[model samples]
Target chain A: MSKQSLGSLLIGMLIGVAVGVYLGWVQFPVEYTNSSMQALAPRYQDEYTVMVSEGFLVDRDINAALQRLAVLGKENTPDYVQDLTERYISQSNFPAIPSMVALSEAMGRLTPLMEVYRLPPAPTPTPFPAQ
Target chain B: MARSPRARNGIRWLALLIGLVLGIGAGLLYTWEIDPVIELNTAPWQLNPAARENYVIAIALSYARNQDLTLAFDRLRAVAPDRNVWQLVADIACERHRSIQIASNSDIIVMRALEQLYRSQGATGCADGQYPTPAPIVFMTPTPTSTPIVPVGPQATKTPTPDLPTPTVPPPVATTPPTSDRFILARVQSFCDAQLDGVIEVRVFDARGQGLRGVPVQISWGGGQREQFYTGLKPGREPGYADFLMERGRSYQVSVPGLVSEPRSIEAIPCEAQRDGQTVTVTTSYWINFQQQAN
Candidate 1:
């Protein structure tokens, strides 16, 4: 092959390689899934229901809801309690949900009950009422 | 001997190929090593909205169960790199839960919860220091009992004729001043004005007209909003007693545990200033009240 033709072919090959690499490495795909929150388990169904119910109560009477929860704590709360709380929180039912400090205390009281009822620990507890 | 033109062109092509490789290498190095390091090192509060929102939701969901504000705040701060703390809280609350709305009307629910907490704790004022306040006294009423005081009373009365000294009972001393009856109250002055760049402020004072220090204050506005602000004695040009940025015409309220006698609200108005021959207007508002003394 002529030297000029060889040079031209080499340059074309280099450009193609560079473009290919840039397209392969530099391009990023947009992630559309909300992968943060995990799916709820069946065992937590009752707890989720209660949480939603309490959340509804919080809209009208936060004090009453708290009182009810406190009373539930004194007794043997059901496994569904945690699920309810989570559901209510997820639904954003409480207008002025207690701060993390207060929520932690409430959860602390509920933890033992949850244990007795044989409910599993929530997916993320550190930031929840426990923090 | 004539050298082919093609042979000479090959040499030029080799030089150009080398230059292109170097340029591409330089670009890759800049993007990978330098750019990524800078982005990774950026503060959590500095993250973009979508990332911040995700972090907030995660932290809030955890906080809802834990109820540990300091930890929740720290976790949230780590995820949300560039935003203000209060603003972050509000965003998280709004995003994760429908109940924690961040609009003006929702302030009442937050204030009411805080009020109940303080009342139950028996906090006299929102002041940072300890002060005397009355505690509820449960006194048992004396039960009436019937007993037969037989002949022994007649024999004792005959010997007791000697003069009996007058009984004296000193009056009850007042332990606290009348002004102590006043309670410290804190309320949101204003919040979330686009013009003010999304800031909120809270004001606190005792019934005796003194500024309270070190009292934690939280302001909740917007439906599904979960923002919280703390109060300190120091005066400054930021949210909390000194100054705050808020959008004009927005409604807000404030809450201080054990201080606010009633929930308070405020609507922001524009304040005017002049700088460099130009008139500048800013929006401001406040919630104010005296602390309720423990009864």
Candidate 2:
């Protein structure tokens, strides 16, 4: 092997090491902390929304559902919910739609898009007979 | 072969630099891909903001129904990952309340839940007054008062005749037993479709299933927590009915005041059921029905 070739090989190795280290540590480092719902990555945000919907089923509080969703940091939560519901429907996720539509309706943001999955109105209580 | 000192040293220097680079490269590879920090057991502090809020909301809901502070704290800590969990919940609630955003009733409950959670832990927050939890109902046992009457007997005149005076024994004043089926007969029944969320549902009725109004009921539980509540006064709840939330694993004794009814006791237990092929989680409750005997 020629002296020049050996030196070139050494220089290439040095460059490779520097570039690898820079990309691994500086360009993308590990993220171990996220303090707010808005800071969640897109995948995690969806999971959080699903959990909130489950909670709504348990409590059946539409207002509480909206409040928990506020953490999403969307300028218009109802619109976001509607859009998400559409996406879920397109993806064939039927069970999640009713809750999303219910939430949107409570927020006064129900759209025609959500009409297909609207929840049935709650039953009205009959007045007890006067004693 | 004997080599020059300069040449040997140079070679050694080159070898050390190459080893350093290779060693660092291998270490970085492992840390970045193969054995990178596993993100499964994420601490609460590690959760993204939205996920954390959802988690905290769940804790609040569980606490609201169960009124179990320890269980709530444990759940909150699992998300916060061991921080001052109660304080964190309070701060989040305060922040939300101050934001002036009206998302819906859920938000209010969440804030209230957080306040209750934090308050139970001695943490104060901005939402302290926003959502106030009604204090648990407490009932005091009524003390019976009786008027003393002087016993009247024949005049204390000396008994002239040896004939024994007819003794008059006060007819046994029929005192009602604590557990009797005379005035009210309380029997607890359960159905998957109870129509309400109450750990102890008191229903007062006649022979039919129709609701009877204005019946006084007493519920006593562990730790001497006794609450006196009335049926058919909640306005929205069914007539002849009243309810109280109870903690799981706790025993409750139910009775109607001023009535001869058997006291019914029940323990709150966790239960689950399937509806339309979907599993639904629910809790067990005691439905004590009082059937007032005919007058």
Candidate 3:
């Protein structure tokens, strides 16, 4: 309440604030993890799987696909696949439906609702005469 | 001033403690809640694992519709930063499909598109089956067949006197193929070549390595990504050397039509050194010279 007390309080407050800022911002800063897919959280794991599925469709390589999915951790992998396929089914995502069904079947969870086949080969080409 | 010395000291310590607590509280509040570190416009590489996957999926979808490989590559590079990005993309797509989360048309197309893009760029992955590219559509014009009609008119008897003068004509000299018209895809390379600077330098040359001028060359990246160029367009440069600038970080397949071998596509790989001290750079244009033997 007195002048001496007020002056000391103001000076102390200034010093305290500078120390606090230094500790929070400089000493112990926030560190980010999960910068790569391998460090993905549970919430994002399904989405990453779907992207991986799209990549599989592109390359059509089953072995590589399995290897990449191996990083999802052995325990949660099957459940994750099941959940994603179920979500796709609920949404009726047609483009991914067949492939997802195929994947589900591979995971030993569900049968494909429909069968898709590759295009038939074309007729033999007629040889052209040499010029 | 009227207070005792001990009491004053006690009050001073109390003030200092209160100040310290209040200051720490305010600092923590400001830094953690109100004005925290914000990563604005986070580059693809800076994204979390989940977000990076989403970004790669978007790139695959974009590539499926537009097939802009150069742009796709640039985007992939941003996310990957290190390691082979296409292989990463391929692995991701394959895993998702294998996991059964991809159950839509766009997802399927994107998967195949991602595969094609990576494979074309020489990266291999596991999903290597049944997603064969649809056969290219080619319209073949059929030549109508007609039966040969037998000559019905009576044949006239040939005279015997014409045989004497038929042997007197001189033989014609053989014409050779033009030097500029016969460029082969002998060394089609894409790099950060300072001389090339990311342009497709279609150099037409003879076996002697002399640059031929004014030779027209066509550079195409499939999907209607085609352009025409001619040598000598730069005046001072060799008459047979022309340049077409490819957007940076793209896999390009150049063909001289009749001259290129089938099933051949080349990408401008990142190179560290070149002949002499000239180095490859992102902005430096490059040359894919074609040489033909002189006629």
Task: Tell me the lDDT of model 2 at A99.
Answer: 67
Q: How many backbone clashes does candidate 3 have?
A: 51
lDDT of 3 at B85: 81
Compared with the true structure, what per-residue lDDT tens digits does model 1 show for residues A5-93? 55665665566556544643465312223221112223222332243233323343334334333422324333334445444456664
DockQ for each candidate?
A: 0.05, 0.08, 0.16
lDDT for each residue of candidate 3 in B1-295, tens digit (9 for 90 to 100): 5867634654576666777778777777776666655433234576676667666875675455434556677778877879778788878767776777655554566566666556444345666433655544655556899989978798878877755655675565334434444445545444565455566666665443345576667666747787666678886654666777766466566656446334246555455556476653355445565655334
Error of 3 at B277 (Å): 14
- Model 1 reaches an interface RMSD of 10.6
**1 or 2, which is superior by lDDT?**
2
Cα displacement (angstroms), candidate 1, residue B179, comes to: 23
Number of the top TM-score candidate: 2
Residue B222 error, candidate 1, Å: 42
Worst 10 residues of 2 chain A by lDDT: A1-10
Better of 1 and 3 by TM-score: 3
Candidates in order have lDDT scores of 0.42, 0.64, 0.59
DockQ of 3: 0.16
